[model samples]
Target chain A: MKIEKEPISGQYGKFKIDGIDYRVYWEEAGQGIPLVCLHTAGSDGRQYRALLNDKKILEKFRVIVFDMPWHGKSSPPENAKVGNYKLSTDFYISQIMSFINGLELVKPVVMGCSIGGRIILHLAINFPDKFRALIGLQSAGHLDPYYDISWLHRQDVHGGEVCGGIAYGLMAPTSPESDKFETMWHYMQGGPGIFKGDLFFYKFDGNIGNEIKKIDNSKCPIYLLTGEYDYSATPEETKSLADTIGIEMIKMKNVGHFPMSENPKEFLKYLHPVLNKIS
Target chain B: MFKSLIDDNEKRSQLSIMAQYLNTSFMISTIENEYLVNIEKGVVKNVEEGPFVMPSYVFKLTAPKDEWLKFLKHTPQPGSHDIIAMLRRKVLKFEGDLHPLMSHLLYFKLLLASLRPVENKNEN
Candidate 1:
């Protein structure tokens, strides 16, 4: 028999945020500057599996990834009513702050993708001194609805498979088959209507373009990285956001929305420079 | 060529469990031609070329031949990447009911992807 184990460690921590209790599931590996990763909507911290296993990244930073409530290993608050999950901006901010404060992480670098990407801008505007820096992958200020999200939660639709199918198109065709399917697999396992709920924040409550003007990157440097192939947050949108904010947007070629998960190797090339500057 | 690709056992198997319930037909209208695809329980029953006065399908996907050419490429560009993307970008238009298409989205997505040439299937 042959077996191997990963260096990553997992645990659950209890926290109270905004009058609600959450048992958040988190995984971590490596040691150095604290790097808190935020996964995309309809997915969880497992998206950072490659980053958690990278030896060089581990040597330079303590990478931590947590599934947001109602995602991955994290369960929705027991006190909450069924089918009432909605991720409001205030609620989302409270959750992240609660988790960070609970763990007593000092000035951790927060890196987020997709909806995670959008929230980091909010974080920067709301709490400039809370982090050392912010990295937004496939981030944008606002996006018009491309399709009717009503299809996502209907009784007739298989929520997980349809979500996965939608996500499949968001990845660059150049990404490896194994990685592309693995990324889609995460969406396929999401709880019903959870993806749509998160989109509420992404598409509606989280439109922070006006509020983001208050972000003084001098206090917390903001790095915007977008993939050319991400239709949800197209490179053009990111570029427009960057232009609005007077910052540069790094356009990653042959990559897409789920950069860290779909093509980690290529993503790292674009990320190393940002990490180095932050360090 | 499209029918043979969809009917291939290996490709049909890749549709997996999603195909079990997808008993529907759809029409694909390119600039120059139209084809009606019929599927039942995950297998392609037939794909018929058309010049008919009236044809029946749950939904119809219409696009220019140039757009289809780009979409069918081994590695499609950003806006042309997927059926959803094409629809979002307005490069592809859909008419008729979308319930069957959206409900069994993965099956349809994989079915269309199977039309790509085998030689470039593995290309990155």
Candidate 2:
């Protein structure tokens, strides 16, 4: 006896956040508390498309994922005139705040990867008692060792190709060819300078090492699941942050920055434990 | 021309807010010598011709004096106008972090293009 592949799907909509009408393209499944997922820089909610369709996880939590402005199907804010769409701390927060309020979610669990992971710190630290829990993937209190990829902006080298190439080095060498291409394919669709704009927060604005002290664990429990292959925010870096903030840290092996997208099946093995603990 | 261009608070503020290419500096080098241009939050603080104490820059863009003069002309020829064009043509050589150079492409392009003297066709 054998089972065939199951088709994955999602529901989508649009919502206004911070005076900007963002086209919210998202998927939701199962029942329980809403688990809002944020994506890494350059890429979009598509990064979590796999998780949204996961059966076991879907059964326990209502999964949600949306693309940021200037990413995926979402429209950029009016302030984004030409190549001027920069993401600020206020804007990033407002987007999430508005989304949560818009959907009328009840103390939803916010999970993010990379810049998504980075912004959760700001959300958790500033809002404090707002969200139920924060699951930061490839996150650090302060993301050090940022690689400047400006040279890749030349016409000779396509920005998307360059975007995909840089991320290629970070993923596990043993990852499936299809999975790696799928992850790289998302990056291949990044908007001009969008990657750099996100890094501004990932590297600087979101580097709230000292700010983490302000966070009260009782208000929102923080769980960091960093990828071992993620040099940008390695396990060592996340461990240091966990040790400093006194939160739980899990080192995800054979995966890089985009765990949910890279090896979702293998990633679930590590994620299940954390989800159970929080539940 | 450089002074007035950099002094324009509107442009600087716009660049800072829109691009957030803050606290970044680079050296523009001609065959004659080098000039250190330091910008903080998009405001140009200093532009001094180099060969001095503790000279530093994120990236150094080098070209011959004549080529620069030609590139900075009212209308530069093919492969002489843009920095990337010049680099592609091997007319301009970079000596440092290319990230800032490429990342803040427009700012630097405008900064260099600002060197073009305001043309007054009727002037004798």
Clashing pairs in model 2?
none
Model 2 has an lDDT value of 0.74
Docking class of 1: medium
Per-residue accuracy of model 2 over A1-279 as CA lDDT, tens digit each: 697644344555678887657766665676777899999988888888677777777777888887887888877755565456567778888998888898899889999998888788888878877788999899877755334455444554457756776665556644675987789888879888787677777777667857777766778898889776676776877888787778768988777778999888878888888777767
Lowest summed lDDT window (length 10), candidate 1 chain B: B1-10
**DockQ by candidate, in order:** 0.75, 0.02
Taking every candidate in turn, the Cα RMSD to the unseen true structure, in Å, is 2.0, 16.0
Off by over 4 Å in 2: A1-12, A152-156, B1-124
Number of the predicted model whose DockQ against the real structure is largest:
1
Write one digit per residue (lDDT tens) for candidate 1, span A6-43: 88999998989897788999999999999999999889
Across B5-39, the per-residue lDDT of candidate 2 in tens digits comes to: 45554434555552354577788778678778888
Provide the DockQ value for model 1: 0.75
